[model samples]
Target: MIKFLLIVNRQGQLRLRKYFEEKVVTHGEQREIIRQCLSAVDKQNFLVEFKDFTVVYKKYGNLYFIAGITSNENELAVLELMHHMVETLDKYFDRVSEIDILYSLDRVHMVIDEMVVNGYILETSQPRILVPLQLLDVARK
Candidate 1:
């Protein structure tokens, strides 16, 4: 099972975070995790083992998509999930960037929520996943 997903910039600023489990982490622990993630990605490592979880991360421009999963989870599948997420965002934002994500965080979270629920992938089809968001856009206009 996946524990959490984090989007962090190169400078170690967190752009987004979503926790699938109900575990509570202290602020210091959260910061330490982010630091470890930054270092892991900087070394060009795709997978890193933590205390009780494994981190799978991919770099896109200056942003890093990181997923923390149980030790038994498949790293490649999580990697593909991150790639699909980036692709979906690219399609929606027309060349997605950090700024785009910062500005439309709600939409971004909605997209992530549509794809994942309770640490499990709910949908892989981008069009089907985006339909509700598109409808929301139309309604807002």
Candidate 2:
């Protein structure tokens, strides 16, 4: 199960953070986790083990999509999940970038929420995942 997802840049600036677990993590601990992930970005392995969880991360342009999952989770599957997310974002934004995520923060969150719920993947079909957002756009017109 996924415990949290973090979007951080090369400079250690956090863009988005979503926690799925019921436990509360303090801001300090969250910062430390980001720091650890940033430090491990240059490592050869994409999977990094922490005290209680494992981090699976992938880099897209200047942004890094990092997922903190249980030790028993499949790392490769998480990587694929990240790729799907990037592809979805790219399709939605016509070339997704850090700036796009920064500006459309809420929409980005919505997209992730569409893909995952309570730490588990709810949907993998991009078209199905996008339908609700499209409906929302049509409603606003």
Candidate whose lDDT is highest: 1
Candidate 1 local Cα displacement, residue 4, angstroms: 0.5
For each candidate in turn, the TM-score is 0.93, 0.91
Model 1 lDDT tens row, 1-141: 788998989988999989999864556777777788777635657887767888788889999898889877889999999999999999999999999999999999999999999998889999988898899999999
Root-mean-square deviation of every model: 1.5, 1.6
- Badly placed stretches (over 4 Å) of model 1 are 41-44
Q: Report the lDDT of model 2 for residue 94.
A: 90
lDDT (0 to 1) per candidate:
0.87, 0.86
Candidate with maximal TM-score:
1
**Runs in model 2 with CA error above 4 Å?**
41-43
Error of 2 at 132 (Å): 0.9
